[model samples]
Target: MTDMASAHLSHDPKWTRAHSIFSAPSEGADVALIGIPAHEVSLSATSAHQTPGAIRDALARYSTYSSAHDVDLRDFSLCDLGDVDSPDHESGEKKVATAVANVRANHKLLIALGGDNSITYSVAAGMWPDLSKIGLITLDAHHDLRDGVSNGSPVWRLIQAGLSGKNIVQIGISDFANSREYSQRAKDAGIHVVTRDVLRKRPMADVMAEALDIAGAGGREIYVDLDVDVCDRAVVPACPASVPGGISADELRQAAFLAGADARVRAIDITEIDATLDTPDQRTVRLAALLVLEGACGVASRKN
Candidate 1:
């Protein structure tokens, strides 16, 4: 076993450690995982660059088997492509695009561990430079349409880069987290908005299906961004923008799994977590790791 595998050894052979399943880069992988630690231009102060590694490390705490889905991630071919060095600037985003473009062809799904929400632009850009052919779904607490190159502005940047706003859906948008200006921008751009209040009344599965249908309209490929800040602050202390009334952790997990289960959903990125800020119980990072597994389980369900 490799060092990572050894550290996560399980007592029972039937119960495999989750971290042990992802191996070195290989061909025909079902899932390809990569780290994009881009925190330089964040709107708020964050040590989010440490999140990818923390999520990876947190995987050691869980088993590959998912009781809910009756699936084992070990049965899938997973690879870790490591991290993109210094992905906090334009040149680095290009590196992210190039790296994603290189491996996306060989994998069924690419799960990009984010430094922040900024990776959404680069990853989606890499997946489909012709943004018109792809749709976007963001599970976030903010509009992410702020005017700048920071983590809060990727959606706007992507829209500027040719992505049609009509095909974009932003869910879990909190009341105080965004400005009326950006809300109007989203409205003007034809971006669909599903507020946090609405989610409180609707089932997560229903919301996910609707978002996927809207974003994946015209049979376009979809990219889902799982920004951790969409969860309640109590659930994700590491997410600076998370609020008291945001979605529950379970809802977020369900959303991720549903996104992964859809055939048209080509890629997903988990973002906005600052590992260093997590509570003593490490709940935030653990939840992020579980989101990865839930997504993998969703992918595994495709064979059923």
Candidate 2:
């Protein structure tokens, strides 16, 4: 606490290097998590651009290295590869594709904390090598399953990357502002849309059973895209498409836990955190940290 607040102390690259998520790193960990704040996005309501650094700073302050899993992520080589400069939309996608692809090759799990949903498209480009057997799980209020032009749609990129039609499942979709045409297109394109209504009805465990049946039935690799809009309006207000009713943070935590528990979830990304909008989200930062931590924990749990 003393070191974190001092000016010279506040910006020490070594402390930043040791604990911050932005240190340039070599690849060799049980799981590789990448935090790329995509807030420089071209859309409205995507305040995600500012989230990466904030989350990293919070983790450095609030969390610590643990060896409980017999693998300390801190002692292990998990480096924050720094933010890809996606000041431009198309170029941002390109950067994400390249950074993620490079990490995907060496690391068992690839996770990206994004600036917007656009990061998803790029991550899919980087990770969708085995299109014949990839499973996508998106926890969002809107079904981002678009036909290459769904507004900020990442699922289109996965399909473009060659992920099969039957391998994508969208959880937590709300009908508030989602397009029916787009919904039908998503369904026709082989994306299973699990409604918010259904999730509300059953226990998260049951939802996992269904998601596993839909996505992991055939030993498919998993990609998780978490849009903060899936959270209720107040909890994560940086996203532009937030609706009246949505999943609670507890629901999201459980969903992430469930996703991590799946054996074939090869890579993960948490997106749509607009930092500029979330002026006072110490909790959001904490949530993102836990999201990444739990993600790693999930992979560790699987290995154990």
Q: Write candidate 1's Cα lDDT for 1-304 as tens digits.
A: 2466356455777767788899898779888889999898898888999999988988888999888888888788999988999987889988988888866578888899989999999889988879988899999999999888999999999999999999999999999988899999999999999999999899999988999999999999899999999999999999988989989999999998998899888899999999999998899999999999988888888853
What's the TM-score of each model vs. the native? Answer: 0.96, 0.83
Cα RMSD to native, each candidate? 1.9, 4.2
CA lDDT of each candidate? 0.90, 0.67
Q: How badly does each model clash, as a count of residue pairs? A: 0, 9
How well is each residue in 25-115 modelled by candidate 2, as lDDT tens digits?
6677556656666655445645566777766665655343334445344544465666777533676667676777766567667667776
Residue 251 in candidate 2 has what lDDT?
81
Clashing pairs in 2: 38-115, 39-49, 39-115, 45-240, 47-273, 47-274, 47-275, 48-273, 48-274
Highest TM-score against the true fold, candidate: 1
The runs of at least 3 residues in candidate 2 whose Cα sits more than 4 Å from the true structure, single-residue gaps closed, are 1-24, 39-41, 45-47, 65-77, 147-151, 279-281
Worst 10-residue lDDT window for candidate 1 reads: 1-10
